[model samples]
Target: MEYVTLGKTGLKISRMGFGGIPIQRIDADGTKKLMKMLVEKGLNYIDTARGYTVSESFIGEGIEGMRDRFVLATKSMSRTKEAMAKDIDISLENLRTDYIDLYQVHNPNMEQLLTVIGEGGALEALKEAKEAGKIGHIGITVHSLEVFEKALEMDWVETIMFPYNIVERQGEELIHKCSEKNIGFIDMKPLAGGAIEDGRLALRFVCANPDVTVVIPGMYDVSEIEKNMEAVEDVSELTAEELEAMEKVRKQLGTNFCRRCNYCQPCTVGINISGCFLFQGYLDRYGLEDWAKDRYGAMAVKAGACVECGACETRCPYNLPIRQMLKKCAEEFGA
Candidate 1:
């Protein structure tokens, strides 16, 4: 496995870090086995979030005695000082760790930063947490270049996590900016949340970018982990033709791409909007038609819950027409 220095943290992370999101769907035993396999394969960095249901707990369970074998990071969405402090405690307990390698503010918008750092708020709490030795490094995760550039200006932040995929090149400039600032750049949605069919090509495309320190792709199965790990062995440099092919795929898919940014959340109707789009992408991209159909059928709201209220579109940074796309998904894949 190829290891790269995670920015100014001075820690080397595997280029293929284990993303903790998919572990929420696996049982305790399964998670334990999968994690052990990953660690055995020399994958060292693990990233999880409090928002991903039982993800942190599962990771904690999986890596209990083997904590020192890997670099662990998690995030919290809490904006207030009190909430941020509380969430940090909860994450610590869930992860069963005394000190996190890195802790991040999850998906902070401009307004959130203003509220959290502008006036004696969560930033102070983060500093206190670091001083208390609860977290080794402070970082932020965001979807837009605007917020990422803002984060680069702050000397306190040592790392950054954001979306960067073959389909979405919006973060290229920000990735370079992070590299210049020595900020650890963790690429989320490296496969565009399963939107890209050719996983090898997609993984290689992101790894080819020198600015990205790590690419955290969610893997539930051992085979999937191995497939991703294999990409590291022979890093395929994308030629001009390959780049054009990726662009063509992106154009053909258009608004169907789900960056998994989770901006259009809380669905008012309680739909797993990201999952719906994700499974659909799996069918279109990977030819897992039956599995995708079954998964979509199992969703509470399926695709029909999109009320066409335009709320999701307005909130989406990518400007996806979620309602219309969901309707199409329902027609094509919903049972």
Candidate 2:
């Protein structure tokens, strides 16, 4: 229920924003019901991406009548001006809104970022969209620390979204700089993309950082919304017990566990990279050997299938050695 101005953008939004990724798992009607709950609970900030498969459209359906009550934000991966313009229109049509509150450049790398700011780049289209009243503010979502750092220097960036969780505090210093520069810092993967099992503790850890303008946890279920609300609404300071719990989470998860963002898709050989890692973690860490093996068997492409093209490693935001990890899984699973 606590509200804060999204720095530089001047938009007042709830600290806990609704992440639109999980909506892809549910139908429009389900999303509509969840949207009603979001409005009733006063979580007025929404985040979605064009790449999130039907998420934007479902949100549009869900927020049809309650558009005025929310500050809607969405992103696209288009790098060219023409592509960005087209994506903007598509986003509008899908969101069922004429004016988007914020439009972001989605996870561009060094070369792409340079290209985007260059002639006939996506930034040109984003600027045009703002001028045309199609969007209110311009922001960016980055997985690379380099991109995040570079984005801070760009005058066009009003907000920056990055993964910040109990296990991944690598951006802690840069995040503080965001507050100093008056740029809104939107926290993505506050739960480390499901690596951190304790949702309440994860949410609490994120909300404790005053620099984070908002934290968007993907929600498809109303029950999740209620539990997240409880975590975000608690205004008290982090107790010693809570801090200890966070440390325990870090030690347990380590840095190598997959966050399941699925950026490493189209695995060159059809390997289910994230799924393989997920099942492997369950088997290795949790000792759920039978269940994990059952699920691993269900995957059409197992870890042994990895040709070690190293494509997934480049795409991984966390710099995970996926090929090697898969090799371990192959040795363990005997696939």
Candidate 3:
């Protein structure tokens, strides 16, 4: 695997990192197996988050003996100094490590961003943790273009994680700025939250960008790691067939599609918002009608359960017309 220094942090890591979100679906033993595989494959960067239930603890169990082999990074949703400080200690204990390589202020809106950097905010705790040798560096993860641009101006932001894939290139210009400013650009949602059906093409598209320091695609199985590694290691130019395929994906999945960040949670009627969109994508794009319908049918709360409440839309950083989209899903699923 090709390795590069993560901008500003001065820590060397593989260009292809392991995203820890999917670990929620697997057990600690399973995560351990994947970590072993990662070591064998020469991948040294692992990104997880405090909000990802059991992710930190699972990783702690997974990398028990070989913690030194990887650079650990994680984030939290806490915005206050007390919350962030408490979270840092919790992360350290859960990861079974004394220090974390990078701890990020997870996705925050413009208002929350100001609150985090304001007096007695999360930034204060982050700096304290850094001085206390609990965290090696600090960064920010963002979903909005406004927050992404704002993070660039902060001197404390050593790295930035944002979505950048074939279907979502809204951050291209700012991503270039990340490289110019010597900040590590971590590419998330390389497959557009499973919207793009072609994994190889999705990875190839993200890796082609020179400004991205590393691309972290969520993986839970060994086969996934292998497939992603192949795409990341292929340094050849994009073939005409690949370019054409990418265009097809762009046309099929426009920017209005959901990235499945799940920021739009707690549906007023308790509907699984992202699950609806995911199955809908399968039904519409992947030709998995039977499978999609079965999964959609299994959900206790269906898309039709939406109460037309705009609560989810307001919380959505992407400002997606979620109610309308859910209505379409209700019609599609006939529920």
Quick one: best lDDT, which candidate? 3
Q: Measure candidate 3: CA RMSD.
A: 0.9
lDDT of each: 0.85, 0.94, 0.95
* lDDT of candidate 2 over 1-335, digit per residue (tens): 99999999999999999999999899999999999998899999999999999999999988997899999999999999999999999999999999999999999999999999999999999999999999999999998889999999999999999999999999999999999999999999999988777899999999999999999999889999999999999979999999999999888888898989898887999998989988988897778999999999999989999898899898887789999999999999999
User: Which parts of model 2 are misplaced by more than 4 Å?
Assistant: none
Worst 10 residues of 3 by lDDT: 254-263
Candidate 3: stretches off by over 4 Å: none
Candidate 1 lDDT tens digits, 54-123: 9999899889999999899999998888888888899999999898989899887889988889666677
Q: Give candidate 2's error at residue 64 in angstroms.
A: 0.9
Backbone clash count for every predicted candidate, in the order shown: 0, 0, 0
TM-score of 2: 0.98
TM per prediction: 0.89, 0.98, 0.98
Best by TM-score: 3
Candidate 2 clash pair list: none
For candidate 3, the TM-score is 0.98
Ten contiguous residues with the weakest lDDT in model 2: 278-287
